[model samples]
Target: MNNDFKNNAIRGPINAFMFKVLSGYMDRLFGKSKRQLFRNHPETVVEIGSGTGANMRYLKPGTTLIAIEPNIHMHANLKKSADKYGINLEIKAIKGELIDLADNSCDFVVSTLVLCTVKSPEQCVKQIKRILKPSGTFIFIEHVKAQKNSILRWIQNIMHKPWHWFFEGCHTNRDTKQVLELAGFSSLKLVSYNLYSPFIPIVSQIRGRAIK
Candidate 1:
């Protein structure tokens, strides 16, 4: 296997375990928000970093779902999840930074817990803007850097390197909300929230939509 596959192989189980451990709380916190957004009922949707197809249940039937994910090991689980959820799925083995779709081809672009992990959050948002139709919506839920000068913030800064290595490039301190605003979306609305983490308050998150 190649280096990329080797890396994915090593990280995939960890990711799976992490998700399993966190999924209950994650679903509880964000499940209603996801359902409400998908109720808008966009026909063509593109989801970035669709790990294990966790968002599949939020989509409406007959919706065309374009799933962009690069990790080979996640594909089987993702496919199974898609099938179980009855999603009209189209899988793309690609990264967010290098989306291979035509401009203005998507009605809705979605990302869940993924912005912090992309190679370039700026580039990924740019591609999201590029692929979205003029009136399309971009929906996202992302972890972000905590309040400046706080103890948790300091911990996030100190732990950034090891966290990146262990989590396969997921940055614990990304200001993802700022990145979305600076990406030049026509209208942006984001709300900062927190997940229930036992150890630290650094699990600061933002979720909302931007119109292109």
Candidate 2:
């Protein structure tokens, strides 16, 4: 087998396992905000980086979810969660940066903690903009860089490299708010807050909607 493939084969399972184990705790930390932000989702929705269906609980029963999750290791658990939630799941094993969906075809696009891990946040946002219908909404909840010159920011800088490697490219200090602002959304509403979690690097978070 190719060395890269071999590495991924090992890393993928570990990451998936970690997500599974921590999903509940994470939900407890962010669930309220997610619930508020995920309200009134369309019947059909596209989710970028839908790992293990962490957002499934917020979706209504019988919702059609097109999940873009590249990590095959997460598919089985994701499917299980979809079934539990009564979601009509369509798994697309693809990256967020280059979605296969046609332009202007999606009514709603949902993402949770995704921008911090995608290879290119700019390209992913551009793709999201391209696919969303006129006046469509892109809802998101993402962890981002802490206040400048703060203890959390210092910790994020110190732990950046190891955390990125261990979490499979999840950046501890991405300026996702700025990214969304520059993405040219017709209207954007974002609220920043600190999550009181043991995971210090990811405590700084923002959640809101951006209209296309």
**All models: lDDT?**
0.80, 0.89
Return the TM-score for candidate 2, rounded to 2 decimals: 0.95
Query: Against the correct fold, how does model 1 do in TM-score?
Result: 0.90
Q: State the weakest 10-residue window (summed lDDT) of model 2.
A: 1-10
Most lDDT-accurate candidate: 2
Instruction: Tell me the tens digit of each residue's lDDT in model 2 across 1-212.
Output: 11132137777889788888898988898888888888888999999988888899999999999999888888999999998999999998887888999999999999998899888899999999999999999999999999999999999999999988778788999999999999999999999999877899999999999999
Instruction: Give lDDT for model 1.
Output: 0.80
Q: Can you tell me which runs of candidate 1 are displaced by over 4 Å?
A: 1-7, 199-202
Q: How many residue pairs clash in each candidate?
A: 0, 0
Candidate 2 pairs with clashing backbones:
none
TM-score of each prediction? 0.90, 0.95
